[model samples]
Target: MVDTTTTTASPGSRLLGLTTLVGLAGLILFAFVLTEPDVRLHPTTGEEFGQFDAVRLLYLHVPMAVLTYAAFLTCAVASAGYLLKRRPWWDVTAHASAEVGTVFCGLVLVTGSIWGRPVWNTWWEWGDVRLMTTLVLFLLFTGYLALRRTPAEPQRQARRAAIVALVAVLDIPLINRSVEWWENRTLHQQSTLAELKIEDLTLFTLMLGLVVFGLVFAWLMLHRFRVGWLEHAQAGHEVALAIAERHAEMETLDVDAAIGRTGGAR
Candidate 1:
C-alpha cells in the first residue's frame, strides 16, 4: 500500500503554533508581573481569606475549569455529529476531544483541590454539591474514555462511545448549577465573573489565562485528531493484511488437496 500521509506542515498548523506560543507568553507575563497582589476576602465573613499570592492560583484554576467544560462540550457535539452522520472523522474528533477534555478535567480537580485546601480548610468535602458533582462529571468522562479503549468493531465502538459521551454531557449542567442549586450546602462561591467586582488587573489576568488555555486546548485537539486518524488508518491496514494472509493460507491448502487427489488417481 502507498504511504499517503503528508510530512509537510500546513500553514494553519504553523499559525496555531505561533498563536499558542504568544498566548502562553502573555499568560505568564500577566500572571506574574501585570496582575496586582491583593488578598481576597471571605464572601460571608468579610475577613481576609488568604494572601494574594495563594489566591493567584485562581488564574490557573478558573481557566482550566472553563476549558474542561469547553473540551467536553466539543466532545459531546462531535459524538452527536458522528451518530447523525456516521462519519469516521466525527468519531476521531469525538475521541480526541474526550481525551484532551479528560486531562483538563483532571487538572481542574487538582487545582481546585489545592485552592480549596487553604481557603476551605479541607482538601475535599463530600457534602459540597459542587465538588461532588464535579467529581461525578470527571468520573463519567473517565468512563467514556475507558469505554472507547475496550476492543470492538469500529462502528460498534464509536456508537457506544457516542452514547456515553452524550449521557456524560447531561452532568455538565448539573455540575455548573450545583453551587447555585445547593447554595446553602456548598462552600464554593457563586459566579463572581458575572458580578464584575474583581479588580481590573486580576480580571485581565484571568481572561488572559482563559485565552492561553483555550489555545492550548485547540493545539492539543489538532494533534490528537491527527493521531486518531493515523491509528484508524493503521487498523485498516492491519485488517487488510490479515485478510490477505488468510486468503494465501486457503490457497496453499487448496493446492495441497488437488495434488493429493491427482496422485491417488494416478
Candidate 2:
C-alpha cells in the first residue's frame, strides 16, 4: 500500500496551507492598505523625510530576514545532529533547511536593496558594514549549496556539506550585529522595533507580518523535508534492489557449480 499520508500531502499540511494563505492575505491587506506610510519630521533638520510608501516593504523584508536566520540556524543544528548520528534523517533535514534558508536569504538581499534605494539614496553600498556582512553570508551559503552538488560519495558529500554549513553559519552573527558593531560606518539603521518607535496598528501589522512569514517558512520547510525524505527513500530502495540482484547472481553461480559436480559424478 502506498503511504499517501507522508509521501504526499496530509490533512495537517493542507490545513497549514490554508492558514498560510489566509495569513498572507491578511498581511497584504494590512501592510499595503491599512497601515499608514512612515511620515515623520527629521529631528535636527525640521524636514519631512521618512521611508514613506517605501516603508511598507519592511513588512515583508524584516520577517524574511529573521526567518532566514532561523532557517540557517536550523540547518546548522541538523548538520550537527547528522555528524553525530550519521542518520539520513538529519542529513535530509539539514539539506532541506539550507535550501530553504538560501532562498530566504536571497529574498532578503533583494528586498533590502529595493528598500534601500529610496531611503539611503543607493541600491547597494560596498562600504556599509551591515550590507557587506549580509552579502558575505549569502555568498557563503551559496558556496555551501554548490559544494553539495559536486560529485562525491553520499557520505562524503553530506559530511562536507555539514561542515560547510557549520562554518558558513558563523557569518550570521556578524551580519546580525553589524549595525550595532559599526553604527558609525553602517548605512543600515538600528532596530526600530527594539526602540519601540512604532505604535498601535503599525506595530500590530509588523508583528502580524512576522507571524505570517513564519508560517510561510514553516510551510516551505514541511514540503522541502518531505521531498528530501522521499528522495532518500528512493535512493535506499535502489541500493537495496541492486544488492538483492547481486545476491541472486551469486546464488545462481553456486547452483550451477552443484549441478556440474553432480553431472560429472554420474
Candidate 3:
C-alpha cells in the first residue's frame, strides 16, 4: 500500500514560504501606517497622538484578533472532519490551528494592553467586556491545547480534542458582543461595527486589506497541518515495521519446529 501522506514541499521550501509571508505582512503593515495618522486626540489630556498615535498598532492588533478567530474556526472545521471521517489529517489540522490561534490571541492581548495603557490609563481592566472576554477566549484555547496533550488512543484523542475546539469556539461571538452585552462603567467608548466606518472610508478599506493579510494565519495553519500529517505518518511507518519484524520471527520459529518434526518422523 502506498502512503500518500508525505508532504510535497522540501523543508527548505516550507521555510522559504513562511519567511516570505512574514516579510509581506511587515511591508503591508508599514505601508498602511504610512498612509495615515493612526492616533486620535484626547479632549482632556491635550495629548494629541498619545500612545494611540501608534495607529499602526491597530494594523497589528486588529489582524491578530481576526486571525485568532480564524485559527479557532479552522480548528472547529478540522475537528468536524476528524469526527466524521476519522482522518489523521483532520486531527493535525485541529492541533495546528489551535496552537496558531493561541499565539495570535496572546499577541492581541499584549498589543491591546500596550494600546490601552496610553489611551485608557491602565494596563489591565476587568470592567471592559471585550477585554475580559478576549482574555477568557485566549485562556480557553490555551487549555484546549494542553488537553490535547493527554495520552490516549489515537481515535479517542482526536475525538476529545475536537469536542474541546468546537465548544470553545462558542466564545468568539460572546467576546465580540461583550461590550454591548454588559456596560463596564469604564470611560472607554462603546464599540460598534458602524464606527469601523468613521475613518474616511479609505482607512476602512485599508483595514479590510489588513484583515485579508491576516489570512496569513490560514497559510500558516496549512503548513502546520502538513507537518503534523507527516509526523503521524512517520510514526505509523515505524509501528508497521516493528510489527512486521515480529511476525517474521514468529514464522521462522514455526518453520523450524515443522522441519524438526518431519525429520524425526523420517
Best by TM-score: 2
What C-alpha lDDT do the candidate models reach, one value each?
A: 0.87, 0.90, 0.75
Residue 121 miss distance in model 2 (angstroms): 1.2
Q: Residue 198 of candidate 2: its Cα lDDT?
A: 74
Candidate 1 residue lDDT tens string, 1-266: 84478542468977998999998888878887777666668899899755456577788889988998999999999999999999999999999999999999898899888877877778898889988888998899999988988998999999999999999999999889988999998988899999998888888899989988988998888888988998888898889989999999887787877889999999
RMSD per model, one decimal: 3.4, 2.8, 4.2
Model 3, stretches more than 4 Å misplaced? 1-33, 38-52, 185-196, 201-212, 258-266
User: How many residue-pair clashes does candidate 1 contain?
Assistant: 0
List, residue by residue over 1-266, the lDDT tens digit for candidate 2.
Answer: 22334455778989999999999999999999999998989899999988899999999999999999999999999999999999989999999999999999999999999998999899998889978888888899999889988988889999999999999999999988888889988988888888898788988998999999999998889999999888777777788889999999887787877889999999
Which ranges in model 1 have alpha carbons more than 4 Å from their true place?
4-11, 40-51, 243-266
Top candidate, metric lDDT: 2
Task: Give one digit per residue, the lDDT tens place, for model 3 in 1-266.
Answer: 53765564767657767765765665565546545655568788877664436555666677678778888888899898989999887899889989989988998999889878877788898787788788898889888887877777777888998998888999999876665677654444565445774455435544654545455675676677778777777778889989999999887787877889999999
* TM-score versus the correct structure, for each prediction: 0.86, 0.91, 0.79
Cα lDDT over the full model 1: 0.87
Residue clash pairs of candidate 1: none
- After superposing all C-alphas onto the true structure, candidate 2 shows an RMSD in angstroms of 2.8
Candidate 1's error at 53, in angstroms? 1.4
